[model samples]
Target chain A: MDRSMFVSISYFLTHLGLIFFMYPTDIIASTDEAYWIPITLGIIIHFIFLSIYMKGLSYFPRKNIIMIYLSHGKIIAWIFLLPVAIYLIMIIIITIRSYSEIITIVFLSNTPLWAIMFLLVLVATYLSSRGLDSILRSSLLLAILFLPLTLFVCFVSFQNVDWRYIFPLTTNDFRFITKPSYLMSYFSIGGVFLFIGFIQPLFTYKPKKILYTVLLLVPFWIISVYIPILTFGNSTVPHFYFPFVEAVDSIDINWLMFDRVTVFFLLSLITFIILFLSLILWMFMQIITTCIPKFRPNYLLILISFISFVCCLFIPDWKDVEDLFLINSPFRFFCLLIVPPSLLILGIRSKRKEKLENG
Target chain B: MGNTMIKVFFLLCIVLTSTGCWNNKDINHRLLPAVVGISKNGDKYKLILELPVLESDNMKIQIIKATGKSIADAVDWLSMNMDRGVDLFHVKLIVLDKQFAKQGLTDVMSGLMRSREVAPNAQMAICNEDLDYFFGNVQKSKPPTGDYLLDFFEKDAGWTPNIALTRVWQVYRSLHSSTRDVIIPIIQTGKLTEVEHIGSAVIKNGKMVSQISPNDTLLYNAFDGQGTQGIVEVMDLATVLILSDWKSNKSMIINEKPFMKSQLNLKVTILETKGNPSMDLIKKDLSTLITNRFHRMLTITQKKQADILGLGQTFRTKLPRAKLKNWREKYYPILKLDFQVNVDIQNEGFLKSD
Candidate 1:
């Protein structure tokens, strides 16, 4: 498969899957009646970040972000790459832990948390070890299979929705549009664009194509945030942990073989997160390999997976996992802000230098 | 030798970790209840569970009764006494006695919502008669009729336009949605039939406030924008009209106070009549009849402070965020509704009449 296809698939899975668990809570906490305010603002910021990130990737054609940064200097490279590596690792840890918490809470109440986490990390590590091509191939296959089913579940959930819940749109406080939770939602929605920089070496993609894909996915993010609010109004959204999952659970597909479509929906999400965890694991491994230069890739993979597994075991419960997410927010911002612009400037400068030397 | 050892270790790991399926229960070892009935007994709850036993050429229903302080406790007690583990996953009907519903179902509803075993779409109804008596009578049928209750609520099966179909999720949503309330059908054990649809119990703020007759339920369904087929008998005109299609459009005007406007377009077929009545005359009388009935239902619901028609939803579109806080209590009753009913007579019957 072409590299651009891989980038799109990986990006789509990363953004769509992880947000399924957290976006509803984030949007509800950010705004009172006007969830659309934060959602609209989040999409705008998403596009801006996408353009900057894509422009930076365009500068280093066929070279990943790690390679581009290494060209500047080892010190500059470490400064740029270390935070991203940490951010990726933190995301993997938080996503696996939180989604495991959800699985335990909703489906497998009797299953131990460590067992779920262990199974998740085990699959992700195996997939990560297979390298980028296999990850992309399997991701594409999974996306092809599950994306339509997920959309159908979203469509069926609308049967019980009260559209009036989203009304009185003008009554929003407007100040919440800039709050930290609202800003953090952009990470949930468009933060996947960071992967485009990392995977630039694998394929050459038209910035326009990537931009279109991001635009196409904006409605999905909107649906993810707004559907729960529309189905269960603002008052009820705060009480539930995974409102979207609950919304899906509330759908009744009597004609279908399965009585609870929520199980199917959760299965699709679990598949996506498995791929997402693998993609993040691969990215973290890629960064570690670039920095260390001589470490055996397989050993590094095992070491990182072990560290993640042990850390996951000690993280007592959801409260501690939530605190870890809060702690990682600044690092998340740092990568989202600094990586793209710095790389874009370096890419532009390097191009100018090459032109001068040629001239 | 090393490769074989590695393969053996992998197989061992797979076998060891696959014990995660320990919680899985076999189908034969579980008794899946088809319906659950709850009644308030002092501070405790009396639960009656009905499950069908299928033998060769004959099907019978088994009833289990238990009491505890809460629904879960009652179920736990029942589970302890059962030969097989009791599962509510296949429960299609949940009957709460009207007296129990009147006492508020907030705790019961929350428990049901939180349970993974209960299907969110299970039909919830209010029973007008004692649940024990109803279940006893139901279980007495030659080849038990308990299983028919599921089909009775199904849209394609026994359900008619006159019946209000309320699901567990709808009940939950209404309990949480400030502008919306639920109408659960009230059922009674019938002398001639297995079970009879009495009317509908209007629930507001987690309690039953009023009950509407089945005829009024048709009007309520119409006003609520559910296109249920209904029959309207005009005694003076010596005619019967059947509503084939129903549509309602609701909007609000936000001035000093909110005013709601609901426009109903109903397509009707003249099912039977003693004498021929002009379409124009039938339309006029039908409009008046529906309009009057809807007004009466609305008045009753408003007086009871139950927004069963969900009129507050229309007002919600225009009300600011803060006003919605006490919408059901302070603003909903004061809001005025203007109803416009238009009846379109499509067919007079198999025979065309003037």
Candidate 2:
């Protein structure tokens, strides 16, 4: 119940990896100027869901998110758990596949793509198979080992920021809320919030603590979009699939042994992504075993990893990777729609039941 | 203890495999080009890569030339022919032929960016002489000085205000921005020197529409907020070095006609005064000199409707999204640019004050 520190640090680490890659391009694609509007909107929506989900979990003490939903009925479980399960699988595929593609583009051109993907899948599955205690402990280690490097990279990546592109500061248009790129920005904001509701058995975290951690994430959300825009301006930023990587590639700081800071940025984010993938895999396996209740946890993890590797191999190229992500938006929407409010309603109903017994 | 050992072994296996360095090549096996000379070869593109010879103790130079359908193709052909892979990561200079630039650099720049080989900040320049002679004589007679051109344009090294500094990303930005144009410095092969810094080419929509003198480039650099190392010789009065406190204010008005005013404030140190000129006379002379130079430069740009000074960037905020597309044709030619220069003498040199 008292492991809030690990919860918060892992929260920060997971979201840090989410912002650098596709998030910047999506946000910049969503709006021309004053990107802060869309950014804050996405964060606020995710924040509300997080608070509600945590509050609901507080109602059922000692029960994890899976058992809480699965205890009700098969219909309730399918309605609540299926959306998140599918979303987790979709993200697992995209993150590993695209991350391998970026590594190929940045430094590992000679290495075949599947080789990288296989390596990523192997590491994540291994970590998740060790179960929850190992995941938490390893996350604490990875955070301490990698957080400073990530911060330094983020700070120095701002070197080429030219404020002149900060022009046309007031768009006065909220229609960006409807832009596909804007709505899909939930890909960054809501990535880690779902994991919190599932963490009840291992530890308890107040929604306020998670909210404060999210407050720190606002700067990352803003910088991820602004650094590329300020450096390249609106006209050139869209040409980039990964704007932050190109923006950092343009930085020419000598005295450092690393010539391409893009490589440094890529490698650091890769570690974070792998850690994040492991966390996702753990929760993913948690759901699968809960559904059947007959399969061994290790066999389910092996099955999931094997299927993920096969799906990743089937993803032919970058275009398909993008299409698959866009196609998964419906599942993402369902997860957002069904996960929190159901927990909250059921939690209130259960509380009434307990009150009747006591009175 | 046995379980811990097995875990450690597994950890070792994962780290070793995941780094993707399984087929790692040593640094010496890679050839990093310092300068790439891009020119036209009949209907195809010719790229000349200038790399440092790896085995040479004195750092001798080597050149590889190839022609293909495009820049990346030529680079690929060169790499296939060479013993080592050619990485453009360290390529610091890209020299384009003047005739090639006149054909519009939009395609070449977009190609370079798309390939993702060259770093975005790699400096871009135009060569008036044919690249064969430029890369040939320059690398041959120069005794393989090992990227002397990079030192030549590098800001903290031997850079001057008269040399306009343009990068690949800046040109790409200008090509995409509806209202913006850019100035890429022009150079030629020098008999004694590696290359001569001649003014700069005023590019509108990736084609050179006009050219400005070295002194004009100084003002362009100052106005573009690039650097304040401008050393101007004001007729027979004095030679003033513009120091780092350079400031400017731009105001614009739009209605039937577009009008814009830029006020430049400069701090200077007097290097040499002809006949010990008065303080007022020195300030007046410096002001008039830069004023006339910028006026001449502005006239050429306005006639060609090139926004090399980036004045259109200010107007970008004023115009809506749709109108911005026709900024150069509809607004730039009619826009008026006026300059006001104020000089403050920070140091009077070694001599006493007048």
Candidate 3:
């Protein structure tokens, strides 16, 4: 697949999975009334960070962050790249644990949690082992198949929506825009833009294409957050664990074969989440292999999967998963803050150095 | 060879463990209840599970009754007693006795909301008569296909524009929505029909606050935007088949009192008439009749403080959070309503003009 196809599909899976599973809870927890306030702020911050990241990547065409960092010095690069690698691994663990908890609660009440987690990690590991090209290829295929189905589900879910719930578009406290939960939403929405750097080397980097992909994703983010608040009022959104999923469940598609379209919705979302997990795992493997060039990618994947599996087991419950997010927030912000600018500066330096050498 | 053998073993293990369904419950061993009637007896709850059964010749239903301190307990007791486990996944109709609804359905509503098995769109109604008597009558007069109770609320089959179709999630939303209330259709066993639509039980804060007759339910549906293909008879002046759409300006404020002005556009086809009333006169009569009836319904709801039309939700847009919090108590009753009804007579059937 081409870079545009890869970038768009990867971006779609990453953001859509996050929106479906995590964004509703985060948005409801963050703001009181007029969720659009925090959402708009989040989107602005996302675009700012994305433009900088894309500009940095544009400096070094066909070179990933690992390559750029490696040029600085291997030891210094290890210090920088190790944290990024750990962040990717942590994201994989957290996503797997959180989604498994949702699956257990919503779909499979009787099935053991570890079984679901194991199955998810297993599939993600297999896809990741096949390499990034395979992951991107499968994403394109899955997006083609499931994106329309997911959008149609969202469209039909408007049947029972009470638009009045979105009213009182003003809030008493404007400071909610800076709240921790609101900031945390950036992790789900914009934080995934960091992966763009990792995949930059795979194809010629085009800033406009990537910018367009990010722009296209903003409405999806807004819809995923607000639909639940619109369907079940702000007063009620905080009560459910996965309000968006429940909102989809609340839709009554009478003429459709299935009484509840939520199952179809979950299946599509789960596919995206799996692909997202695969992308994360692939990123982690890339970091590891880049650092230790002698290590086999297959062995490194098994090692990463094993470690993630063990880490997933330790997450006893959803609250612990939440605490994990709180603990990881600073690290998430650190990577989100540090990697883009560092890459931008490096990209600039590399370009100047290249001009000097060529001249 | 060893690596291939290990992979084969793992594949076989996965295939063995993951075969069949995720949570496999055999269909033959599960009882799919079509209608569940809940009534309160002191602190305990009486549950009647109506399951449709197929005999050699005709369709019949098996009614199972159980009692417990809570709905869950009753369900567990029923599950234990039946040869086939009771599954409420397919439950289409949830009938609550008048006493149960009056006492407050907060607990039952919360329980149903928490359960994954119960579909959110399952239709809910309030039985005017005792549930025991209703279920007994339903058993005695078993209609063919055995979906007698389900068909009553099924829009495709038995539902009319007059019947208020309140789903479980709608009831839950109403309970949570500060400005909104729900109208559950009140039903009873009829002499001629299997079930009768008596009126609607107006629920405020999860309890039945007031009742509206079926005649008022038509206007209620019209105001709430569900009225289509409904018949409106104005005394003996004219019988008109009416379809209505309404738009309301909820931002109107007059001297610290919230004001709502609604304009209802009614498309009418005059079906029959007692006198040779001109189309203009018939339109005027319908306008008067609907305006009066709507005002009467509004007055009743205001007296009861039940915002069944969700008029408070409209005012919610203008009010800040604090004022919105107190809207139902402070602003709702004092709110003034101005109704403007516009009737457009589409056609008078074969007689093009009267």
Q: Estimate each model's TM-score.
A: 0.95, 0.95, 0.95
Better model by TM-score, 2 or 3?
Answer: 3
lDDT-based ranking: 2, 3, 1
Cα misplacement distance, residue A125 of candidate 2 (Å): 1.3
Query: Please, what are the lDDT tens digits per residue for candidate 1 over residues B1-354?
Result: 644553465456556665787667779988889899999978999989998988776788888998999888888887788777788888889999989999998888878888867877789988888888888888897656656888888877888868998888778877777878989999888877888998999999789988898999988776666776777886567455555555555666556566777778878787776666777887888788888888888888878878887777766666665777677777777778788887777776688776
Clashing pairs in 1: none
* TM-score of chain B taken alone, candidate 2: 0.93
Sorted on DockQ, highest at the top, how do the candidates line up? Answer: 3, 1, 2
Clashes of 2: 0
Residue pair clashes in candidate 3: none
Clashing pairs in 2: none
- Provide the overall lDDT of each model, using Cα atoms, as 2-decimal numbers: 0.79, 0.82, 0.82
Give every prediction's interface RMSD: 2.2, 2.2, 2.5
| Error of model 2, residue B187, in angstroms | 1.5
Per-prediction tally of clashes? 0, 0, 0
Better of 1 and 3 by lDDT: 3
lDDT at A49 for candidate 1?
71
Write candidate 3's Cα lDDT for A237-292 as tens digits.
78777888878877776688887788878988898999989888888888888767
